[model samples]
Target: MNKVIKIENGTKQGVLNFLEHLITTDKISGVLTLRKINEKGICDYGFISDAKELKFADPFAPVMPINAAQTLSSLTPTTKPIAAIIKPCELRGFVERVKRVQGSMKNVLLISYTCGGVLPLNTFQGDGSEKIIADYYNAISKGETPGSIRPTCKACEYFVPMMADITIPLLGNSESESECSLIMNSEFAIQISKEFQCEIITSELDSKIIDKVLAVRISEKEKLYNKTKVTKDGLDELVNIFGKCVGCHGCSRVCPICYCVMCDFESHNFDYNIEIFETELEQKGALRLPPDTVFFQIGRLAHMSFSCVGCGQCEDVCPANIPVATIFKKVGEATAGLFDYIPGKDLEEAIPVMIFKEEEFEEIGK
Candidate 1:
């Protein structure tokens, strides 16, 4: 059964207080959430063992320097259970990783909030003041799209946490009000409530408002996909789009689904001998130094596009300012759509490539 808990204190403080309560009650070994790293307004993940550290917790901060999914993957096969407050995209990415055996969900409790989109890391570094962050949250709560939000976030349709144990609903809530409803979506959440002293109320979610927001977001996502759609007409278009790739492999590095310990592109196979380089030069008149840019991109797309969550971390870290996220998201949508699948939608739904069905993809056989 779903349960709602109302917080009389401010929502931000309510979240912190709840985290503290969990720690004090020994419900979790630690809490993983964002904390201010310095006075420069920088914030990153903080794994807090003590309740007092909740003072620095800022789970609602509209900035994602790194996808916490990769961080969670790094902590897999963990020794102790912990609670993690994550964004919708991060939760989705983690779910995908769990299915691939890159992470474990056995001892983790997911606490997710309605995401209002986030600013680019560079933009946040420039002006991530308290007032700006507060104003952004206020705008989103009011169903307004502030211009500072990243394009990837603006186009994101999965802004609500569907797979979370506990979800904090912020939509349709008054901006002036300090409190919002906490929804318990899983038995674990109900169990936690029984142990904690918070009042649990039975209330239905405002599905109408959520649906309206989702419709708008889906429309935006379609527009984005159309704008970035790739074609198989020719390699000229592909080369033009990826012409500036300097082979830094930033996209692969930030991709949560790119879990290979040693990628083929990074292997010595890509390294050419002097004689081979001379042969290539003789055939093509001249070759680009550090060849096979398009090869590397297509290789990555084939390898990981099925699980791409479009978090924009790849584009965020790219030195060449390539629209890596847009390309990947567009391709991922088509690839996943081919199997009538949605990445990170469910834990039990086997990956399309991993499962074979006689009735599946009959069009291909035809």
Candidate 2:
């Protein structure tokens, strides 16, 4: 049976109060959530053990400095239960990490939201940041997508998370009504609510409102893909797009799927030998300072195309402003479609590359 609970103390405060109650009453040992670090609106994930410290924690903050999934990879398989508040996309990324054995879901109570997307890091840290945040919540209150959000977020269809222990309905909710709704998904969520002594109401989200949001995102995704897609014959176009790369590897660093500690692209294998440089210079008359920029992008794409979650962290950090997320999203969608796979959707579903089927792609082999 589906269970819902409404906290009547406004959206952010109500959620915080619930979390505080859990901590004070010893429901969970700690919480892994986004906490504001300073007045500048800079924030990162904080693993908080004390209920009093949650004053700095803002689970609804519209800024994502890093996907919390990568952090979970480093901090999980815990000895005690930890409640993690993250966006739907971040939870999906965590599932991908867990499947790869980079993290464990042993004692995690995942709390996600009907996401309204997030601001790009630049905009979040820039001038009038407060106005941007205020405007963000305003859009949510009105059941409209915000104009100022990460490009990848505008196109994301998976804003409503699956596989969460609890889900907070922010997208289709009216915060002015002074009620915060929680969709208790897993048994753990129900148990926690009962332990906290909260009334469990049976209600569901308004599908009409959610569908309206989905329609806008789906339409935005099509337009984004068309704008950034690299065609089979568009090598020049590909170069024109990725050619601005500074070889910083920021995209890989922020990618949840690129879990390799030692990337071959940064290894001695790709080093510039004097002879190879001379040969390349002789042939092309001019060599780009950092050679194989395009090669690196394509190679990384091949490595993660099946698992890319379209978090937009890559483009967020890219100095060149390449639509790295969009390109990867387009390719990832195509590759994952081949196997009818959606990464991070199910814990039991094996990654297509990790499992072998004798009859799989039989027509191609024939």
Candidate 3:
């Protein structure tokens, strides 16, 4: 059964009040949410222990510098319980990592809100003030989509969280409304509700609003997919897509799924002798300075696309502007679809490549 908890004020102040209540009431040890790094508007995850620090908390910030999953994975199996405010994509990425044993959900409370997407870091010019965040939230609550949101976010299919302990619904709520609705999805959420003395009432999700948004997003995703589709299955096409790669490996570094401590690309095998480079130069008449650009990209696709959550961090950090996220999302969708698998949907489901059945993929074998 679903229960609704009314926030006395709007969501901005209501959330801050709730967080303070959680800390003062000894419900959580700390809070993990976004805070400004400096006077600039740049925001990153921070662990707050003092209620006074809630002034810096901007859980609804319209920017994602790095996926919070990586940060959450690093802090998991923690000594004490903590509350984490994360975006839907970040939560999904964390779910995938947890299944891989890279993260733990033992003592963490996952709280999420309706995401209105985010803008690129370069475009952000605010000072991470509460008013700025509140204004943006109010605008989004009024059904206005900002023009500065990222392309990937505009076409995102998973803007609303599904597996969170608590969810704050920003859609279908009028800006004039004094209270915000909280969706309790877990027993932990119910406990929190009781502790806060929030009224528990039966309520249904606004499925029509969600469906309308998803339909537009799906259409946009198809358009982007077609535009980026490879016409031929050949090395030449891949080269065109990845030819400008400088081999900085920034994409792998930011990827939550590329968890290998030592990647094959950085292994001793790629450390060739000068004579080998001379031989390649003689044979091909020309050689790219650092070879295996195609190999590295294809290797990553094979290794991580099965669990790719399409956070776009890979493309965000790419120096060459290779549209890495687009390619990865396209490939990831196709590869995962073949097995009827949705990464992060179920923790018990095994990774496709790690398990096999005689009946599976029989057509391919034949």
Candidate 4:
């Protein structure tokens, strides 16, 4: 049974207050949420144990410094239970990581929301930051898609979380500005909510508005897929797109799914060997220094395409302005679709690559 709890203060404040309540009442040991670090309007995930410290917490901050799942993966399965308010994509990323043994949810209460998408880091750091945030919140209040969101966010259809223990429905509801509603999804969440000081609402969420946002996101995704479609025709288009890579590999660094401790791409194995260099020079007449730019991207795509959560962090950090997120999103969708899979949609569902059956894909051998 889903239980809804209504908070009297504004939505953002309500979340802060609730986190404080949870801490002060000993419901949880700490909270992991976005908190303002300085006056410059920068925010990042903060683990707060003191209820008074939640004053800096803003669970709805419109910027993502890093995919919080990576941080959660590093800190989780703690000695004590804690609550984390993460974006839908971040939660999904954590779920994917958990499946890979990169993280654990044993003592974590995952709270996610109907996401509004985040602004590109450049937009947030540039001038008019306040107006951008104000406009974003205004759009959010009306349950409409905010302008100037990241490309992946515009194309994201999975804005609503599937596996979170609790959900904050922010899409399409006008009352989101004046109050906050917590929808307890799991039995644990319901039991924990028994101590929360809020009114229980029995009404169902309005799906009409959510559907409108989803339709726009789907349309945007189709447009992006058309623009960034990698062809089986040749590597010429692939070379042209990734040719500008300076080999910084920022995309892989920020990718939550690329959980390797020492990436093969960065190892001595990829270093220039005199023999291979001479051979490549003889075969192709010339070589791109710091080789395998396209190979690295494709290699990662092959490795984690089925698990990419479309958080836009990779594209956000790309120095070359490569549409890394869009490409990954398109490829991930197609690859995951082949197995009738949705990454992070279910905890019990095994990843396609992690499981094999002899009866499956009979036509592949032929």
lDDT of each: 0.81, 0.87, 0.80, 0.86
| All candidates: TM-score | 0.93, 0.96, 0.91, 0.96
Residues 1-366 of candidate 1 have per-residue lDDT tens digits of 368877777777887888888888888888889998777778888789899878888787788878898888887767767889988899989999999999998778899987878887887767546666667877877776656777778788888886899888765556425775678888877777576666778885567767877887788777776776455446887888788889899889878788788999999988788999999989999888668888998988898888888888888888888888888888888888888888787888888788888776567855
Best by TM-score: 4
Clashing pairs in 3: none
Query: Once superposed on the true structure, which residue ranges of model 1 sit more than 4 Å away at CA?
Result: 128-132, 175-177, 229-233, 362-366
Residue 263, model 4: lDDT of 95
lDDT of 3 by residue, 61-178 (tens): 7888788989989889787778999988889888888888988987888998777777766556454544555566665676555556666776688878868888887754574258
Candidate with the greatest lDDT versus the true structure? 2
Cα deviation at 316, candidate 4, in Å, is: 0.8
What would the per-residue lDDT of candidate 2 be over residues 20-136, giving only the tens digit for each residue?
988988888989899988888778889999999999998888988899999977889888778999998899999999999999988888999889999999888787799889999
Candidate ranking (lDDT, best to worst): 2, 4, 1, 3
Clashing pairs in 1: none
Error of 3 at 43 (Å): 1.4
**Steric overlap count per candidate:** 0, 0, 0, 1
TM-score of 4: 0.96
| lDDT pick, better of 2 and 4 | 2
Lowest lDDT 10-mer window, candidate 4?
A: 225-234
